[model samples]
Target chain A: MTSNASGRKNLTFISRRSPYGSGYAKACLDMVLSAAVFDQHVTLVFMDDGVLQLQPNQQAGDIHAKDLSAALAALPLYDVDNVYADRDSLTRRGMFSDQLAIEVRLCDADKIAEIIRQSDVVFTL
Target chain B: MTTLHTVNKHSLNSDLLTSCLRVARGGDCILLIEDGIYNVRTLEDLAARQGCELSGLQCCVLHDDLTARGLAEKDLPDFISAVDQAGFVALACAHRQSVHWF
Candidate 1:
């Protein structure tokens, strides 16, 4: 772990695209997984269209993409336990935490800003 | 300080690989991730030309991204090293900054 090499730097990946419309959501997940594999401290935030990524029963039936929810569920396994969704983003879409496919904390804009402030690197995928 | 130029597109489809190669300085290193791993052959060629043409340019690919795309590591030439996510973190830490060409 790089935690001891230097004070651990937090890398936060912000996902702003909906699932399956393009590669953005998957890219964010993959990048987060990579950071976690490197043993770097990392967090993932879903905002904007990204909130759709956590929606339950997502089916790419005809488009044929990997089941991203399964991967989201696997985040904790990779030590990426800080998955969060923007509260306003979710509310605007009429979504609640119970409606999500996986577990993620609902965060407001202020908290999102704080996380960004604390991050050494912020990747907005 | 060395700059880590990260390319995240396919060579056959995008110009990110060529652009990174053209502008990357002597101390800079190229890291292929996402679809960029498809350019391993191009990167290997650049690495092979280090002495006669290019100088001090290192190349590597993200192992997870490579395998996620169903690419085999054995096929990668000896010039490029496959690094895990932690290795990627070390690279980002060691370099002055990262330039991602999507």
Candidate 2:
């Protein structure tokens, strides 16, 4: 699945579950970081209940859960900056783009479809 | 490149199918396995309720999973076809990549 001169593939990760509900969110994050370490072009799309992971002021410690926001904040450092969130998902939950803890490019259904079509590999978790 | 999007959850238990259908393109294929086979009878209704267009998409249900779930090929909508294990493998070979949505 290698593409481009540098051998980077268009890797897309779609996170659709709520953080802390299970290990899926954390595992997905770990996989993304790992892919970035390999110099792959990683794109993360947060949709469905996954949009809730971007909510600010999360006190995950009270629930004995790791701080996902802290991990999410490290995305830019890893150069995995192609972050997106489904517009419909955010609106359905009454969340606004400005309210998220991190900056994410909001994508409509059609844009998301295009993203998938362009991906060389897609991981949905 | 075409993608095979596989969903493994029942419609009522999770919105994985809806989420998968949202981004699935025209040439992409959707395979329902595990509890996802439970959606055989209501896939069209669910898609309609979510405003998802399935006109150009190829929908399939795993035959083994359908049999295990006590469903028959006749239960599937005309838009969907039953694929055996070999057919599933053929689909994987035909598609550029496969995404599993649970």
Calculate DockQ per candidate and list them: 0.02, 0.80
Per residue, candidate 2 scores C-alpha lDDT tens digits across A61-118 of 9998889988998999999889999999999999999999888999987887777878
Query: Candidate 1 chain A: minimum summed lDDT over ten consecutive residues — where?
Result: A1-10
Give the Å error, residue A57, model 1. Answer: 0.7
Tens digits of per-residue lDDT for model 1, A1-83: 12345666688787877888898889889999999998889989887678988888877664677888878989989988888
Which number leads on TM-score?
2
Q: How accurate locally is residue B95 in candidate 1, as Cα lDDT from 0 to 100? A: 77
lDDT (tens digit, per residue) of candidate 2 on B1-102: 888989899878888888887778888899999999998878899889978889878999999999998889988888999999999999988998898888
